[model samples]
Target: MKLVVEVKLLPTPLQAEALEATLCACNTAASWVSGVAFDRRTYRNFSLREHTYAEVKTRWGLGAQAAQHVIKKTCDAYATLRANLTAGRLGGPGSKRHRLASGKPIEFRAAAAQPYDDRMLSWQLDARTVSIWTTRGRLKGLAYTGGREQLATLARYRRGESDLVHRDGAWFLLATCEVPEAQPNSKPVDFLGVDLGVVNIATTSDGHVMAGRRLNRSRARDHELRAKLQRKGTKSARRRAQRRRRKEARRTRDINHKIAKHIVAEAERTGRGIGLENLTGIRERVRLRKPQRAMVHGWAFAQLGVFIAYKARRAGVPVVYVDPAYTSCTCSRCGYVDKANRVSQARFVCRSCGFVDHADRNGSRNVRARAQAFWRSGAPSTAPAALTGLDADGTPQPAVCRNASASRQ
Candidate 1:
C-alpha cells in the first residue's frame, strides 16, 4: 500500500523564501510547458524535452533537475487530458467531454509548490532535515516534525515520490510510503453483513449496531454554532466557526477510524468477509425529505467504507459489495420483498411471512445473502458448510460467522 504522511516543516525565514522562489520558478516552467504542449498538440517526451530543457534553465532560471521535474508534471497532465478526450469522444460511460478538448489552452495556476522526484529530493543528514534542489541553489537545514509513527513506517517501506505543498501559512512535506500486500490466507467461510445508515452508523446482520447518536449531536452543535456565528456578524466569529467545523470533521474522522477498526477486527475473528451495499450514485437516484436529505448528505458512510477497505486489505480480509435495492424491505426469512415490510424507521415486519426484525439488520441480512450468492456463482466454494444462507429465524445458517458482531462486549 502506498500512503502519504505529511510532516510539518520548520524552515528559517530565508530558507522559506528561497524554497518559495524555487517553487515559483518550477511552476512557471510547468505553465510554459503546458501551453506549448497544447499549442503543438503533442505531449511527447522528446519533443517537450527539446523545447523545455534549455529554455527553462535560461529563461525561468530553474535548476536542471527542477526543470526536468516540471516537464514531467506538465506532460503527465497533458497525457491524462488527451486520454480523457479520447475516452469522451468514444462515448465511454461517465466520461464527459473536457472543455480543453475544444482546443482551448490548458491553464496551470501559479503556485509556490513543486513536486520533487526521488532524484531531486532526499533526507539531509537525518529525518529532521530535508534537502532539495532549488532554482537559486541547494538549500539545506529545512527541518520537519511530528508523524512519528508515519516516519517509522516510511523508513520501513519508503518507495515513492512526495509533493511539497504550501497551504494555510505552512509548508508541508507529503511523503509517500509503499506497503507490501499481505498474502491472501484469510479463507473466509462466510460474510458479515453491514448496513450503513444515519441513525446507526453501521448495523450488522448479527443484530449489533454502532449508533451514531454522538455524531448526530456533534453535527447539530456544529450547525447551531454556525448559525450563531453568522448572527454575530463579526469576522472573528466567522473564522472561529470555520475552525470549529474543521475540528468537528477531524473528530468525526477519528471516530470513524475506530469504528472501522472494530468492525474489521470482528470479521477477522469470525473468519468472514464483509458484505456492504453498493451505494454508488445513490445520492442522485434517491430523493428524500429535507431533514432526511441533510442527514444523509452529512453522513460519512463513504469515508467509513474507505476505512474498512484499507484495514481489511491489511488484515487479509475480503469485502463484498451487493446491490442495495429493496434490502430493507426484503424478508430475510422467506425472501418476500415489499416496501410495506419496513413498518417504521427501525422496525421491519414482513407482511407476507409475518416475520419481525430491525430494519437495518434485515437490510444487512439481505446484503449478505446477495453477496453470498454472488460469490458462490463467481467462485467455487471451498467450504460447503459456510454457505451463509439464512435460517428460519433469519440468522446465518453457518454458525462459524454467526453472531460475530453481537458477541462483542
Candidate 2:
C-alpha cells in the first residue's frame, strides 16, 4: 500500500528560492513539450522525449533528471487527455474536440514541482534530512520535521518521489512511502455500512455518527468571509482571505482523516467488511436548489470515500460499494421504498411498515443490505435500482419491491 506523509521542511530562503525556480523551469519545459504533443497528437514517451534534454537543460538550466521529469509529466498530461476524450469525458463548449490548442503554449499556471526518483533523491534517517536535486545542483541537508511515528514509517519503507511544495508561507516536503499490506482475515462475519452526507458527514449502521454540522458551519463562515473580502477589493484582504481558505482546508482535511481512521478501526476490530455508498457522479445525478447545491457540491464525499477505502485496505478490512439507489428512501425494516418515506432531511417515517428512524441511519442499513447481497452474488458491484422508476409515459412509478432483479447481481 502506498501512502503520502507531509513532512515540514526547514530550508534557507535561498534554498527555497532555488526549489521554486526549479519548479518554474519544469513548468516551462512541460508547456513547450505539451504544446508540441497537442499539435502532433503524439503522447508516447519516445515521441515526447525527442524534444527533451539538450534544449531543455540549456533553456531552463535543468539537470538531467529534472528535464526528463518535465517531459514525462507533459506526456502524461496528453495521455490522460486522450484517454478522457476517448471515454467521451471531455466535451462541451471551450473544450478541445478537434482543433488544436492556441499557438501560445498552455503553460501550467502553478509551478510544477520536480519529482525525485531514487536516482535523484536520498533520505537520511538519523539527520531527518533529504538530499534533493535542484537546477543549481544537488542540495543536501534539507531538514524535515514530523512525528516520530511518521519518521519511523518513512524510514521503514523505500521512499518514493517527494514533491517540494510552497504553500502559504511555508516550505514542505510531501513524502510518499510504500507500506506492506496487513494479514488476511480468515473469516468476516458482517459488514458495517457508512452513509455519507453534508449534514452528519458519516453515519454508520452500528449507530455511530460523526456529526458535520460544526464543519458545515465553519465552511459557511469561510464562504462568507471570502465574499466579504472580495467585495472589499483590497490587496491585504485578498491575502488574508487566501490564508483563511488554506487554514479551513487543512482543518477539514484533518477532521476527515480522523473520521476515516475511526471508522476503519471499528470495522477491523469487529472483523466486518465495510459497506459504503457507490456515489460516483452523485453530484450530477442529484438535483438541488441553488442554495443547497453549493453546500452539497462543496462537501468532499469522494475524498472521504477514498480515505476510508485506503485505510480499510491497510487494516485488512474488506470494503464493498453498494448501489446507492433507494438507499436513503428504502425502509431497512420492511424493504419498503418510497420518496415519501423520507419525511424530512433528518427523519424517516415509512408509510409501508411505520418504521421510524434517522434518515441517514436508515440509509446506512440499506447500504449494508445491498453490500450483503453483492457479496452473496460474488460479482462486481452494480448500481442499485432507482428509488422512483419512470413508466412508459415518463410518470413516476409507485415504489415497490425491486430486489428480485437486484439479486441477480
Candidate 3:
C-alpha cells in the first residue's frame, strides 16, 4: 500500500557536492557492514542480521533517521544478491550479481541525519548547499523544511507507482505513502486470462491481444552504431556507445511499463481477476540461438508480471499465475493435446478436435482454467499452480493444455 513520491530538490552547487560526499560515505559504510557480514558467515557459523537505525547511527556517526534510510537501502541490496545467488542467477563470485558492479570497490556517499521526529531525515542538498549550511550562506532556491504540505503529498501514493529515489546527482525528498483500498459493493463474476509470450507480449482469454512491437529497428540501429564504434576503437566512441546503451535500455523499459499498465487497467475495469502463466522456470526450459537468447533475457518478463500483480492488488482485483504447461499446444475447445496442434509461431490448430485459435489465445485460456481450478481448491492467492505442463524429465508436454480460457464474448 505504500507509495513513494520523488520531488526534485533545489540546492546550490556547493550543497550538491556536499550531498554527494555524504552519499558516498553512507554507501561505503554499508559496503563495509555487508563485508563484515559476509566474512562472519564465511569464517564463523553466523547468519547475517541487518543493522538497525540506532546501531548504524551510533557506529557510523549518522543521525537516527538517516542511519535507518541507509540501512534499508543496504539491506535491499543484500537481499538482491542473496536471491540471485540462491537462484543461480548470479555469475560466480567474481561476476556481476544483480546491481553490484563486480570488481568495483564499494564506496559511501553523503551522510543522512535523522530529524527530531521519526518522519524525516536531513542531508546536504548538494556540495554548494553543504557549504552554505556550514558557512551560513544563502542561495536562490525554494526553501521549505519537511512540513505538513510535504506530508499531504506523501499520502497520495498508490500501489504500482514508481518509487521516488534520491540519487547523488540530484537532491530530492521522497516518502512512500499509502492509498486507500477500494471496495466494490457488488461481487465480481468475470475474469480475464492473460498469457505472456516472447513474440506477442500478451494475449487475453477474452481474445484481446497486445502484440509485441518489434524493437528490432532500434536494436539494428544500435548494432550499426556499436559496430562503427568498435571499428573506430576510440575513447569517444566508447563513451557514445555507453550513452546509446543507456538510452536503449530506457526506451525498452518504457515500452514494457506502458504495456503492463494498459493490461492491468483493462483487467481492473472489468472487475475481474487476471490469470497469467507461472513462468518461474521458463528461461531454463527454452532453447534459443545466442542472439535470441539475449533478446529474450532482456525482455523483463518478471518485471511485467510484478507490475500487473501490484497494480491489481491496489485496484482491489486479483492476479493468478497458473501452470504454464501445455498452454500453447492444448486445444481450448476440447482440451486436446498434440505436438502438431501448433501450426506456427502465431497460430494454434488443434489436431485432435480441429480447434483453431491464436497461439497466445490458447495459452491465455489455459491460464484462466488454472486460475479457476486454484480458486475452486481454495488455494491461497500467492500459491503457485499445482500441475505444471512439464513431465518427469522437466520437458513440457506438447499438447497438454494447462491454462483455462474465458469465453471471448
How far does residue 141 in candidate 2 sit from its true spot (Å)? 1.6
- Pull out the clashing pairs in model 1: 1-179
Model 1, 1-409: lDDT tens per residue? Answer: 5445566788889888877887777777788888887788768877888877898889988767778778877777777566656746435544344543545655555554567777778875365788877766777767888566766765676666767776556787766556555565446799899998888899988888988998899898888888899899799998888888777777777777788898889988988888877675677698899867766877777667766766676677777778789998899999998999999989999999799999999989998898788777775322111122223332221111101110000
Top candidate (lDDT): 2
Name the weakest run of 10 consecutive residues (lDDT summed) in model 2: 400-409
Which parts of model 2 have CA positions greater than 4 angstroms off?
39-41, 84-90, 93-104, 232-239, 382-409
Ranked candidates, highest TM-score first: 2, 1, 3
What would the per-residue lDDT of candidate 3 be over residues 258-365, giving only the tens digit for each residue?
776777788777777778777876777989998787667766666566556545655777666777888788888898888789899988998887888889888888
**TM of each candidate vs. truth:** 0.77, 0.85, 0.69
Give the per-residue lDDT of model 2 (tens digit) for 198-317: 899999999899999999999999999998999998999999999998788777777877888999999999999888887877877889998887788788776576667667767888
lDDT of 2 at 176: 68
The TM-score of predicted model 1 comes to 0.77
Q: Highest TM-score, which number?
A: 2
Residue 359, model 1: Cα distance from true site in angstroms:
1.7
Which lDDT value does model 1 have at 401? Answer: 12
Model 1 deviation from the true structure expressed as Cα RMSD, one decimal place: 9.4
